[model samples]
Target: MAEQMGSCKYLFMSLLMLFQVVQCRVLTVSEIVDVKLPHQPKSFRIDLVHRDSLISPLSPGNISSTARWKRVLERSNERLRKFQLDSRSYSDKVSDIKDAQAPVSSGTGEFLMKLAIGTPAVSYSVILDTGSDLTWTQCKPCEDCYSQPTPIFDPSKSSSYSTVPCSSSLCAALPQPGCSKSSCQYYYTYGDSSSTSGILSYETFTLTAQKLPQIAFGCGENNQGTGFSQGGGLIGFGRGPLSFISQIGPSVGNKFSYCLVSTSDPPSKTSPLIIGSAAGLNAKTFGFTPLIKNSVHETFYYLSLEGISVGNKALDIPAGTFELDSGGSGGIIIDSGTTITYLKQSGYDAVKQGLDSAVSLPQADGSSVGFDLCYTSAAAAFPSITFHFKGADYVLAKENYLYHDSTGVVCLAMMPSSDLSIFGNFQQQNFQILYDLDSSTLSFAPAVCDSL
Candidate 1:
């Protein structure tokens, strides 16, 4: 009788366990909907196409390599000239549109990005410029506008579009703010005398599948420029309160990253530009350099370039050669708009001397290719170049600093400047670059940009 009771108790316990399992599995519809999962960080990504790419509307199809390199150098020269002239303080405010002579230029940025704006999204191609501040696009009903391949963005069609009043703090953030009645107006002049004047407004910016609302931008009714004819307008990635990155900083955790593909790659291949939480960027793998601050010109991203190396030998560059002075004159900037890197005369000389000593190949004239250093043999092995930044050593692949022109001559892809030095897009190719404004750091790692 005792054994029978024990068996019955065991059966009861087994049935109770099975009932509990069934109860847990049979969740109500509302209860299932309310269940929480592990949190995942969100990121937005877009493609960055080279302007000369076949996929880009700006591409001059079938152009010779010599012609392409010449155009890049010309634009670089214009961009550097603008940077030199743009030394004015951002703190200075302009009371009216007439008083606004702000020095900001497109310099014919090499990369183009496609995004949509407004309530009913209208797609537009725009220059992806890291050196610029305000994101502006040519709008409909133009007073004066440059020729663009696509239809101009019509603010009237955008239901979500709204103009900022002159009294709003958003309007006050403009370097040179103007008042057209109660609406805030803006005027910006490029280095090449290209200009854009329009009302300051807020709209929804759709990048990829993500819709970012309430973004401050310019609706340029009067716009004139040579380089801007290819694309609709520009999207600024500069360090300023009015810049696209700054406007989206809160949502993105003040982080952004990009990987530029080599120009030698097929024009169809595209690089990726990411904002918010960047994936595959582990701190252990990336080398970081602190970003230097310039009080006078706050838009540009400055770096401390301690020195450079050719092969194994470090160039003997004088201290403070790349330093940003109290007056904000000399410094090194990483610019995405410029195709070829530019070093100050002194620094360039040191690098040129180092290359001359390291290279054993027969010397060739690179004047036609817009370079000072050239080698007759394109297939010959060459020494690697490395940029020595503070707390980081960035090694460059042969493709980064050397290019084989259409004439079958390999040339150094760097130039000399009188005042400012720029680390341009060529050197940055095939590298994943992360800009963390929160940490005040810039991190980079070698990557196959196309794969990323």
Candidate 2:
């Protein structure tokens, strides 16, 4: 049986799917809707923990740089700890304030949307995530508890949702070797505490206008925890088919991408995550860099670093160091688990210095948040900070670097002086990032950000 062959004893079959080779072609922004993405098998999780010790291209070598990087990360750690304390200490105040500013739409929790899986119409709410992958949700039983913000997907109600036979070739290719059971039991754990477990099924899942004819996915029977609080389930962006975009592949579009605009920004102006092909990037203007082979899962996209720069001034550091992860949050999440952006010592220092020179904010006691600038007051225009990817310079927008917190406090710099540089969502949103699994190249171009 396919399931038995894909189990622990069938390591070869798993390897074939995980490392299958294919010739890759670059897709232009306009081609996003034109190309069909290949249906490649995705993986479960990274085996190793992402530690600060890992080299970042920007961080490179230089004892002072390393120390400074650590110092900044330490400060960030302290600030985050304090932020958590502040959150708990001023919980009531913050909560009340949030309630007053919260839009009527915000309180309703999940947003309901119809999803079609391989020609079958199934109703489900996809919890939009800027920070995760592996989209999944409740299905079948529809019976018990777990109050969801939107309606759950009923397989019987869907003409297309069907279970993958235990012996199917595709079913046996699940990354988690032994997990290819007849009943379809699979589990996934994220860098965050969020996780999901469910049975595999094939169906036609649809987005607003995007449609995947026959996509494979996990139809969770028991969806629980704070992770599922927002809606029916998650619509992950990570390199896994568990995500709607990943499952749809070349059939719907040749590639997948999204642009995350700020929530504070106007509704009409939204970030788009384009799958198959991106919309604004000029393929001719874009440069390419070798993507790191899955140091973890075959599905993840990674890049080896040489170094980074601010303008013409390049940070003196080692080459062939650092890795790029799209899954990071904030501006650049240097670490695997930490949610905030972790900048390299030089990058953080330069950015912070620029901010400090431009604006100022005061602590409760009037002592400035101690940065070159603080977000407590209205912001003044700051200098542009360009992240040097390989030899290309990718510029960041003003909004991409600054954010007003829940208290209307603007954070001039997203990362604390001490965190490792992680090109997080803040920086990522400005460019059209392409992860070519076949060629193992990470390519992007500046849309709002300076050209790369």
Candidate 3:
């Protein structure tokens, strides 16, 4: 069983970032094409290291007797609350393909990137979130900031640092709306009550041997709530115009892909996040799904989920449940920050029955676990679930579809949604998922993530 609250700190901060998407407006390069900048490397690699991989096995002295179970229940509650909040947020149809809340344990096992910011090159560990678009870090001279492991970055020491003026086109894209000051300022709040406010600026960003000049980033001087973690800040890789991909669009060719290790696997394993044209070679693995863009929320990446098949039979759910409608109806969203998958009610029920029929294990009560479809059986055979996308069928193994709780109960990892359905990162484990904005298509191919 996975430890829960241990990672809640990262979860809540990521939650705050995603929530800001709903309130902020993105002003992208299209609006500021005339702004000339410096040259950047055509392609390079950023080594990703998962913090969990560094942890030692929990000894008896490390955890209290009941603390483990309590953590599982608490984390489960966080997942339910997040699912409900995101369903409502997406249903509200804030005019995007969309926004979502992640499971609390997500950050505990998520991949982190080591980034070098400023001309002097101050380094910090940051979470890489495909679900969000803005890249920010806690800066020095803060009015109010959360505690971070690294010394807060002081932009004044960096020779290349320059604040974006309110008159600049990038400032107009900010969610802050009216700008009275010369510096472009942003105030972002999350559904969980955390907020970040700071000045927008461009800085030199370095990852290993590659150095990217004139990268736009938020230099947060005033941050509240889950503002920072051991992973000092977050790097958003969303489809938005202001996202990492968008900012590096010219160099990367708008293509990137990652293969997440199975959450059930030990954190000792790390994965690759191939950027630029190199990700294009992953297409040879097959199982290509056409990607869709939401007109309203340009940052979100959307995919059509045709149906889910249990074994050889498809569930008795309606196809329209996964369809993206302009009326803000139900649709499927793919997000990496989320640790579990969520299905609409009818679809969820059908899958549940299939599990109940296929596995002979007695159904364990899930009240304390915060979900349904759990059992006490060990090494039981679980019906493999295949998510039929637009043109590809991505099948999941027993390890990917089942959850082992703290109390020796194995439960279906997926949750039931009232309206919105999300393809969380958990299901994408060991799959090389390619996001290509150039062709507007996402592809997937199974691979041993550790080998990647």
Give the number of the best model, judged by TM-score: 1
Which regions of candidate 3 deviate over 4 angstroms?
1-40, 55-109, 178-180, 227-230, 281-284, 367-369
Q: What is the alpha-carbon lDDT for the whole of candidate 3? A: 0.70
Tens digit of lDDT per residue, candidate 1, span 221-291?
Answer: 99875656768889989998889998877566788888999888988789899888764364458789998
lDDT of 2 by residue, 304-358 (tens): 4454444345655433234433533112221222223545555656556555544
Q: State TM-scores per candidate.
A: 0.86, 0.59, 0.80
Query: What TM-score does structure 1 among the candidates reach?
Result: 0.86
Write down the lDDT of every candidate, Cα atoms only: 0.84, 0.45, 0.70
Worst 10 residues of 1 by lDDT: 89-98
Quick one: RMSD of model 1? 8.9
Q: What are the candidates' C-alpha RMSDs? A: 8.9, 16.1, 16.6
- Model 1 residue 391 lDDT score: 96
Residue-level lDDT for 90 in candidate 2: 38
